[model samples]
Target chain A: MQKTASITIRRKFRVGNLVFHVLVIAFALFMIYPLLWMLTSSFKPGTEIFKSASFLPETWTLESYTYGWEGISGYSFGVFLGNSLFVVALVMVGNVFTCSLTAFAFAKIRFPLSSFWFAIMLGTLMLPFHARLIPQYIIYNDLGWVNTYIPLVLPKFFATEGFFVFMMTQYMRGLPREMDEASRIDGCGFFMHYWRIILPLTVPSIITTCIFSFIWTWNDFFSQMIYLSKIETYTVALALRQYVDAMGNSYWGALFAMSIVSLMPLLFIFIGFQRFLMDGVTMGSIKG
Target chain B: MNGKRREACAGYLFMTPWLLGLFGFTLIPMLISLYYSFTDFDLLTPETWIGISNYVKMFADKKFVGSLGVTFKFVFIGVPLQLAFALLLAVLFKKERRGIRLYRAAYYLPSLFGSSIAVAILWRRIFNKTGLVNQVLALLGIQGQNWIASPGTALNTLIVLQVWQFGASMVIFLASLKQIPTDYYEAATLDGAGKLRQFFSITLPLLTPMVFFNIVMQFINAFQSFTPAYIVSSGTGGPLNSTMFYSLYLYIKGFGEFQMGYASAMAWVLLLIIAAFTGLIFGTSKNWVHYD
Candidate 1:
C-alpha cells in the first residue's frame, strides 16, 4: 500500500512538471513570436507577407536580401555595416584603454581628492545624457565636426563612460595588491606597472567593458543621428532609419531583410558572450 | 616630492583622460546647458540672454506640455507594468530546473536587442495594418488597425514593447532572487508553508530592495526611451503626436528646429524630473527595502 501511495505521488509530480514546462514554453514562444514572425516574413515576397499569420514563408526568396543590399541613394548597405564596425572597433579600444587607465588610478592609487573625483564619476553614471547633450552638440558643431564620426568616437577616448571605469575599479579592487608590490619591486614605474601587471590581470573586466562598449556604440542612434548626415558616412543604425523614412512601407520585404542583416552582429555577440552580458548586468545592479 | 605626494601625482596622471572628459564633456557642458536654458541660443542666430523666458515658454507651449504628458504617461504606466512582469517572470524562472539556462537566454535575448534601432524598426512594421498582429487578429474575426499610427493605441504599442523587454529587469530580479538563502525557504517548508505562502512571507520581503532598484533604473530608462518612438512614429512622434516621447520632442526642437534655448530649458527640466523621481523613490524605499 505504501509503494502504491509513493507511485501515485510520483505520477502527480510528473503531471505538475509537465504543466510547468508547458506553461514556461508557451510563454517563451509568445515572447519571441514577434521576432520569429519578422524573420519568416522577411523571406516571403512582399505580397505574401500580409496574406498569412503563419511563420513559415509560402515561398522563400533571396530577392529582399539582394535588393536591400543594393541600398538606396547610390550607397550600398555594406558601407553602413562597415561604418558601424569601424565605429565599434575604435570605441571599443578607446573605452578599454581610457577606462582601464582611469580605473587603475581609482582602484590602486591613493591620490589627493581621489575619492571626491571618484564620487563625481559615480554621479555621472546616474546622470541623464540629456544634461550635457545640447552643449556637446554645440561644441561639436563649433569644431566643424557635426557631420563626422569624430563626435561619436572621440569622447570615448577620454573615458566618458563612467560605468566601465567603476566596473573595472570594482574588479581591480578584488585583485591582489601583491601583484602591484611585485611590479614595484621589479622596478617598474607607474606606466609599466599599469600596462604590464594590472591590465593583464584585469582581462575579465576588460572583456566586459569591450563587449558593452561595442554593443552600446553599435546600437547608438542618437549621436549618430545628430552628427552624421551624408549617406557615405551613415552607420547601420542611421542608414536603417534613413532607409525606412525614405522608402516607407512600399518595400516591406527589403526593409525586414535589411533589419535582419543589421541585427546579425548583435545576434552573434549575444549567442557567444551571453554569460558575460548577464554578468555585466548583474554586477552593475548588485554592486551599486 | 615625497613618496605619498609622488603617488598622488601618479594617480592624477592616470586620471587625466577621465578628468579631461569630465570637465570637457560632462561637467562644463552641463553648466553650459544650464546657462543656455536662460538664453535664446538658436544655432543660426546670436544667443541672447532671455531671463527665464525659455522656461516660461516651455510651460505655455502646447506641444511641450503634450510631450511632457506623453512622457509621464509612458514612464508611470510602462515602468510599473514592466516591473510587475519582470518580478513575476523572474520568480517563475528562478528555479534550478532542467534547461533553465537555455530558457533564460531565450528570454533575455529580446532585452539585449530591446533598445536597438533594428528591433524598433521591427516594432514599426509588426504593428502595421497589414502586419503580423493584424494577420493574427483576422483569425479571430477581429479587425486590427495600424496600432502605431493610431494615437489611442500608439503609446500602448510602445508600452507593450517596454513590457516585452522585461528580461533586462528580470535578470536583475533573478540575480537577487538567487541570492536569497535557500535555508529561509527550507525553514518555511518545515513550518508547513507551501511555495506560494513562502513566496509572499519570505520571498516578497527579501525582494523589496531589488524591486526598488529595478523601478528606479527602469523608470529612468523608460523616461528616456527614444528609438522606438522615433522609429515607430518615423521621427515625427505623430499620428496626432500620441507618441511624442520627451526625448524625441526635445530632439526635434533642439536639433530639428534649432530651438536651442527652449530645448535647453526642456533638457534641464528633464534632469530635474529624473532627479525628482529618483529622490522620491529613494525617500520611500527606506520603509520597505529590506537589508541585512
Candidate 2:
C-alpha cells in the first residue's frame, strides 16, 4: 500500500513540473511574438501582410528591404546610417574618455567639497531634459550647430550625461584605492596615473559607458529630430518616420523591413554585452 | 608652489567639461527659460515681454488642462500598476527553478526594446481597429472597438502599453530579493510560517528600499513618456485629444506652434511638477522604507 502511494505521489509531481514547464514556454513565445511578427512581415509582399494570418511569409522576397534602403526616402539610408554611426562613435569615445576621467577623480581623489559636488551631481540627475530643451535649442541655434551633429555629440565630452558618470564612479569606488597610491608612489603624476593605470583597470566600466552611449545615440529620435531638419542630415530613425508619414497606405511593409534592419545592430550589440548591461543597470539602481 | 593650490586647479580642470555643459546647456537654459516665461518670444524674431499673462493663459487653456488631467491619470494609475506587476514577476522568477533563465530573459526582453520607435509602432498595430487584439476578441464572440482611434479608449491603450514594459523594475527587484538573507526565511519556516506569511513578514520588509526606488523611477519615467503616445496616436494627440500627454503638448507648443516662450514656461512648470511629486515621495518614504 505504501509503495503504491509513493508511486502515485511521484507521478503527480512529474505532471506538475511538466505543466509548469509548458506554461513558461508559452510565456516565452508571447514575449518573443512581436519580434517574430515584425521579421516575417518584413519579408512578406505588401498585399500579403493584410491578406494572410500566418506568422510565416507565403512568398518571401528581398524587395521590401532593398526598397526600404533606397527607394522610399529620396535620400538613401546609407547616408543616414553613416551619420548615425559617426555621431554614435564620437559620443562613445567622448563618454569613455571624459566620463571615466571625471569618475576617477570623484572616486579616488580626496578633495574638499568632493561629497558636496557629488551630491550636486546626483541632484542634477533629477533634472528633466524637457525643462532644459528650449534653452538648449536656443544655445545651439546661436552657435549655428542646429543642423550639425555638434549639439548631439558635444555634450558627452563634458560628462553632462550624469547616468554614465554615476555608474563609472560607483564601479571605481568598488576598486581598491591602493592602485592610485602605488602609482603615485612610483612618481607618476595624476594625469599619467589616470592614463596608464586607471584607464586600463576600468575597462569593464568603460565598456558599459560605450554600450549605453551607442544604443542611446542610435535609438535617439527626439533630439535628432529636433536638431537635424534637412533630409541629408537625417538619421535612420527620422528617415523611417518620414517613410511612414509619406506613404501611409502602401509602405507599412517597407517600414517594418527597415525597422527590422535598424534594430538588428542594436539587438546584436545588446545581447552580446547583456552581462555588462545587466550589471551596469543593477549597480546604478542599487546605489540610488 | 603649494600642493593644495595645484590640486584645486587640477580638480577644476577635470570638471571643466561638465561645468561648461552645465552652465551652457543646463544652467543658462534654465535661467533663460525662467526669463522667457515672462515674454512672448518666437524663434523667428525677438522677444515681446509679457508678464504673468502666459501663466494665466495656461490656467485658462482647455487643452493644457486636458493634457494635465491625462498625465495625472497616467501617473496615478500607471505607476502603481506597473510597479506591482514588476514585483510580482520578480518574486515569481526569484526561485531556483529549472529553466528560470529563459523566463528571466523573456520577461526582460520588452524593457530591452521598451522605448524604441519600432516597439511603439508595433503597439499601434497591436491595438488597431482590426488588429491582433480585435481578432482575439472576435474569437471570443466579442466585438472590439477601434482602440487607438476611439477617444474613449485611446489614452487607456497607451497606459496599457506603458504598463507592459515592467521588465526593468522587475530585474531590479529580483536583484534586491537576492540580497535578502535566506536565514530569515528559514527561521520563519521553523516557526511554522507559510509561504504567504513569510513573504509579507520578511520579503516585503527587506524589499522596501527597492520598492521605493522603483516607485520614484517609474513616476519620473511615466511623467516623461512621450514616444508611445506620439507613435501610437500618430503625433496628433488624436481621435479627440484623448492621448495628448503633457510632454506631447509641450512639444506641440514649442515645435509645432513655434511658441518658444510659452513652451519654455510650460517646460518650467513641468519641471516644477515633477520636482514636487518626487519631493513628496521622498518625504513620505521615511515612514515605510526599511533599510538593512
C-alpha positional error of residue A46 in candidate 1 after TM-score superposition, expressed in Å: 2.0
Error of 1 at A52 (Å): 2.9
- Give the root-mean-square deviation of each candidate in angstroms: 2.2, 2.8
Candidate 1 collision pairs? none
- DockQ for every model comes to 0.70, 0.53
Clashes of each: 0, 0
- Which regions of candidate 2 deviate over 4 angstroms? A1-16, A71-73, A279-285
lDDT of 1 by residue, A1-288 (tens): 979988998798898988888888898999898888878878988878777777898899988889889987888999899999999999999999999999999998998898999889977877888889999998899989977889898999999999889988888888898998998889998899999889998897888888888888888898899889888999999988887877766787888898889888988988888878764342643454
Query: Which 10 residues in a row give candidate 2 chain A its minimum summed lDDT?
Result: A279-288
- Model no. 1, DockQ: 0.70
How far does residue B35 in candidate 1 sit from its true spot (Å)? 1.5
Q: How well does candidate 1 match the true structure in TM-score terms?
A: 0.96
Residue B243 local lDDT, model 1: 92
lDDT of 1 by residue, B1-292 (tens): 8989989999999999999999998889999999999999889888999999999888898888999999999888888988898889889889888878878888888887888898998888888888778988898899989898889999999988998888878888888888889999989978999989998899999888778877877888788889999989888999899999999999999988898988888989999998988889889888888876
